[model samples]
Target: MAGPSYLVNILDSNHVSAPKGSVPSTTLALTYLDLPWFPSAPMQSLFFYEFPHPISHFMQTTLPTLTQSLSLTLQHFFPLAAKLICPPPPLKPFILYSDGDSVPLIVAEFTGADVDHLTANYPRDFKLLHPFVPELPPSTMSSDGILVMPIMAVKVTVFPNTGVCIGMAHNHVAADGSAFMHFMRSWSSVCKSKGDSTFLDEESRRPFYNRDAFGDPDGCNEEALKCYWHWISSWRENLAGPTKEISSVDKVRATFVLTRAQITKLKQWLTTQCKNSSNDSEEVKISTFVVTCSIMWICMIKSQENDIQVSTNGDDDDDDDTFYYLLFAVDCRNRIGFSLPVTYFGNCLAPGIIRAKKSELMGAKGIVTAGKAIAKKVKEMESGALKEAEKGPSNLEEMFRSGHHVAISGSPKFRVYDMDFGWGRPLKIEFIHIDDGGSLSLIESKNESGGMEVSLVLSKNQMDAFTSNLAESLKAF
Candidate 1:
């Protein structure tokens, strides 16, 4: 029942390690915290495409396109290269394509021997909730990013198993998750096509990797943001909850996907019903992710109630009735207000919060209310007109202290979408085991049949719910 000892150690490391610079130059900073004690869980071992057909070909044609894009991108954001620690030789890494234009392919190769160790943890280690993001229950860890660096003692006896961690740690600094995907798509096209991507129009690509989002000017009164940060930062301490208990609580986490078809339809339907003014010039904006999250949050919260009434939730006997925050990661690296040149990389994401009382969530519009809150939070984040996750200095870590309890998470979106390291096109793309603080990571998977295939790690019950939803989705799609 005790989680790995490394858990506390790594978490502590992130809290105290301030950025080398007291002031974060860019809106984001990615520091390598030594995981003296990383949360130990299931270790995955899988192969991309063993036979290796067009992988080399894919890499040869597409690597330059990506590297070139990254190089040009870095010139925009000066410190990006140092963050990723890219070798001077500028090694051209490979990328993978996704099932659709939305997903990505990651190739993670591991030794077969390690399979036993991973299998032992299986659903538990892989699906358990994150220890730090206590509101999320255990399963949230699965969907978020993972931390895998053996205790430095136990050597994972796996062979031939490997995986790709997020590569943006290097070039393409300002590419938001969306733009990153765009770049990946281009790489995939080059890998799958007969034409050359070497001639891509540099101007055609949108400007991303900018550093101004953090300090962008918008309606957010600096006083208001500072106040909110102080209030919210203090509030986070009480909500972290007790130790992670994987068994009873329903695992609550988040996911990011395009508006896709079905969810988009649902949003449109809801738009017609909302009494809110359609008068806004931006139009009635909604997305599949919003709709899906609304529905899921409703179900999880409502599942606690015998009826839709809020008070009824407290009387419920079920153990899974606990309510966890459904936090969505948004990348502010590219929002319009950001003035920093493209190529700024690091963790340029912010968490969108939708809080729900255990019982009130069962109300008919509970999910809808939560969804709106999510949208509203996102709006608040980009108050400066830049689509940043929050309104604050890029380097908030400068103020970090040992006793300070802060919750941060982000979406490493669209990283390996079109990576082609000259080995044909990468048959797979997956981020390596990476852990910073309380972070939830989602990366593309390697599936021959195409479509999106992802591997998430979460706590127990939350993992159960997540898997249940995933299975349902697989069937529905």
Candidate 2:
């Protein structure tokens, strides 16, 4: 049966406001977290919110309010209105803000689909969400061949009586998930307060953009940049362009809700397993993030057993030579001591990797091993991991190109459900192009209660097996 689909009409497209008149152009140097995304892959997200009012009321009343509120909100976030400027060598990349600059705000409407089906937990055609996402401006190269791209673009689509979805595509170098959420929360706050700027909190009103604030005591930014350029140069052949579009993938996307009780059970089971293990020195500090991520990682790997068997050409199925890695990213705002504001906007994340052999992952201690690896990485972050990244050698290219990688995007800590743009909280929030490239989005469930919505894209067969394994494993817990 054909899944739901829709056509998007680009009703309006224009830029939002930025700092004008006598305000000197603001330039923010790229930090370590920002450098990796230099060539820029715009991360897109769709937030589905239920609107009780009729379509006319929304188009007439609500749309104007949202538009105005977003404009007012953007006034404070001028960088979103700006473009990334990378001059010729000897000049580092920075955000350039000038008068009349604005973010591209697109209003689109989608039709010919069932809204209920679109919002459901069951697997659906990932292509259905593509039209809602506005395309980012293509990257431009200077006469000297330095590349720069648009920082952000936004689209808001309506589904008649069903609901509305706000689609956003932003440069990762410009803002990490935390910074992005801060902007979004601020926009919603403005909308909820009837465009009252006064009601906004300090975090929203004042996002520290000082790139110098992060005391790169060990010159992590330079080291990271060097490592990044090296990786890019090596992968230049594969970097030509995206090989496949969203429609080319025969994949399904599903959002599985894991309640707090289920996650707690999983963690407890891991803790008990660790205690019974031979390694008494290991501390069982399995957190909700670690436990949930570990479970998903396990399920994903287990579900691919058939593929592994086929690829190995009848080699030992239990081969310890095969590689498996769980690539996760962490926000370093709090870990940097007192240098940067917790609300400091812009990229503040560094990647963390935990790898194991395929045999180890398929073993009984799989969950415990994965959990411990994550715990160790977390501890490392607490003890100057960011600073150490400068001196340590980088595997950025290898890790990215490795077929064994399963990365985590977004976070459960963001409380995305709390965002209310005057209508109500979102019914569902999912990454649009997650299927194009494989990555797991871990976000707080919309229920307000403690839980996680694990959203990912996998081929049809793998998705079915993954879902089945996920259910069975959680049931066992």
Candidate 3:
């Protein structure tokens, strides 16, 4: 028997720009925070909603509103429609926007696809979700060899009367999660109000693009450039080659939830453990994010314990000392010791890393161990979020070399489920790019308050192990 398949028909494709004369042509220099991710793959996300309308009705009414509202939103966020201009060595890259620059918007129809299955919490073929997302246009080389790359692309796939999926892909150099969510909310607000943006507050209506807000006291920008140069030089050929697609034949994507009650229970258990520990002099800051991530980290490691051991058979003496790293990004808007607006555009994030030995994470008190490491890292951020910003690239390089690492892709604070594009709140929201790396995505739960929705993509066997471990660990709390 043949495997499952999905059929997508392209109906229309066009570029949507800000209103004429609304945005001025300009160039924005890359910041230190954006330099490291300059050559990384674009971030892709999918938002699923129930339309319950005919295809003709959607194209006649819904599609036009989305495109028009997107255009209006672009007037305030012109950088999203700009192009990344990368020159040769000795020169820097910047975002450039010409008068006619626009973002590609694609409208398509997904036939014979079960929207309900795609949006369900159960495991499903991960590859089925790829077609809905729009890929960034191929980078073009100018006469002088400058690489011109588009910053963003959008796609809307209609499932007849069942539902619709809105997929977006964006270059990280253009903006971070906070800035991206702001744009999303602003666009949804305008569409909900029928193109009237007066209801939005000043902070929501406009983005702060002044790069000077990010103060680099330690000259981290210069150091970051040096690191980026080394990396780009080594990966230049791969960067210039065609995009590589990962095979998802035996891979499955699944959604898991941590209810508010379960989270509270886990936090209480960790607090008690900390109090009972012999080394009680040290303080451990615990939050929903800390506890949630700690448990997930433990589960992930335990699920892959066998594979980890086999990979380290050659060095049994050091198998117990093998290091595993958990990495996440922290927003620096308020922590940078300045009065920068929460709406500051572009990337303003610092890396938060937690390192532990394999034995520590797989021990009987693994959750406590992981929680303490994460809490300590969070507490250190209080002194200075970017105190060690210069070492970010080097630390990441070391983590990859170790081959036991897991990074986070999304934040629950983004509140993606709350985005209502005049239809209603999204039935489901997913960070599609997490499949590219050993990363998991977290978002605010759609049905439960103070809860989190965690999504992961793993091999079928590993997923089964993870699910079992997750259930057993949660039951203990």
Candidate 4:
């Protein structure tokens, strides 16, 4: 059975352009590091803002104010308003930001829903919230067969007397999470100042567009292209039939909160266990991210193992031999040895992977072992691993082809909580595009407390098993 069906009325839809004469027409080249994520899923985020006043107050006052401020902010972020013009291969794609470039902004009204239930700290059927998310233009294959992508889209849904939610769909290649946060913060600044153009600081108002500052001494560009093409070729060959969309009926999304006390205890446990287990030169530094991610990673693996155990009637020796990999994106802003501008706009992230066996992860020292493996990868970043990032995730692709793997979607360092658009700080931030199996999202807790909120996506059965395993594992801490 389903809950009450909410009604969504589209009140307005129009393109909001950058202020006239404010931004110049320009083209920003897409780097090799950015091109691999070209066809990847668009990063989606939903921000809920609650107001004590009536919904009419938001529609009459706050709505227009936000629109004008957004326009002003877009004047500085012109690339986001432009079209991603991709040429047929061997030629790289570039953003064509001409004068009068605008982005689509949608305003809608919702009825027959409880904003409290929608914004609660637990997971509900995603369909209940799906209507609030506006659909972006899909990527198109042109007559000449080149893929054209949309850079960004926005939607604002107002829930009558309760609150409003802002939905954003952004292409991953245009900007990493840091750049995305920069744009939102700038918009919030303008709105807070009552549409003042100068409210943003000089650093926040400007985005550095130079690609050569990355110092790619080796020709990593061609290597990246080769890897990307190989992936596309393989995908086409393997998935030639009609693709089936995943049924939301069998899936569930949920957020797990890690309190400061829990995090401290987890770190202490990992540190003690790590010291006893390894004699490697690299001492395991158990940071909050390392410890927390290690526990979740181990729990997820255990849940999968339990599923396997049941399916095989407890006779599958092959389960012990399964290889698992943890892949995460490392932001290279501070890792490249030299300093790039704090506001560098394009993608400057490198993919990193850590390998482990399922049996090891489900073992007694699993959390410590996983933490050490992640620590080793972080060390590579400190040692100038960005130099090799343009080659793409070489080992990750092979592992994805062979067996089991889990990937982290976002990092905890992104200041997502600072985005205040005058109404208030966001009540929650959710990554809506995390559908692939074993995918998890990490974001700073919304309470501004020094803790983490991990969002997991899994089948109903897997989620039930994961929560149980997570509870048992935390008992030691």
Candidate 2 residue spans exceeding 4 A from truth = 1-5, 19-24, 141-148, 199-205, 227-247, 278-282, 310-318, 336-338, 391-393
lDDT score, candidate 4, position 258: 84
Please state every model's RMSD to the true fold in angstroms.
Answer: 13.7, 3.0, 2.3, 3.0
User: Which regions in candidate 4 have their CA more than 4 angstroms from the true location?
Assistant: 1-4, 139-147, 199-201, 227-244, 315-319, 387-391
lDDT of each: 0.34, 0.75, 0.83, 0.76
Instruction: Tell me the lDDT of model 2 at 456.
Output: 88
Instruction: Kindly indicate the candidate among 3 and 4 with the higher TM-score.
Output: 3
Candidate 1 clash total? 74
Q: Encode model 2's per-residue lDDT on 1-477: one tens digit a residue.
A: 255545666666766674356235677777776766655457788888987666677778888788788777777777887887755444576788777777788876777887777777888877766777777766565576455657778888887777888989887778888998888988889899888866444554567777776666567767656745664455434423222354565777888888988988988888787667636475747788888899988988887775555567767446576778887777778675436676788877766777888878888778777887777777777756565345334655666566777888889878888899977888888886466536888998777476888998877777888899898888888
Tens-place lDDT per residue, model 4, 1-477, is: 166677888888988889888878898877776767755767778888887766678878998899999999888887888887765556667788888877898999888878878776565665556676656665565677455556888999888777888999788878988888778888887887789877454764577777877554477677666655554544443322112255645666778888888998988877887888889856867888888779889888877777877888998687566778888887777565536666888888777788888778878888877999987777766765665474456665776885678888777777777778887788878777776566888988877477898987776677889899988888878
Please state the error at residue 420 of candidate 1 in Å: 2.7
- Summarize candidate 3's per-residue lDDT along 330-434 as a digit string, tens digits: 887877454567888888777888899888888999889889888888887765677645567777888889988998878988989889998899989988888
TM-scores for every predicted model: 0.44, 0.91, 0.95, 0.92
Cα RMSD (Å) between model 2 and the true structure?
3.0
Q: Candidate 1: worst 10 consecutive residues by lDDT?
A: 147-156
How many clashing residue pairs appear in each of the predictions shown?
A: 74, 1, 0, 0
- Global fold similarity of model 2 (TM-score): 0.91
Models sorted by lDDT, best on top:
3, 4, 2, 1
Best prediction by lDDT: 3
Pairs with backbone N, CA or C atoms under 3 Å apart (clashes), candidate 2:
16-103
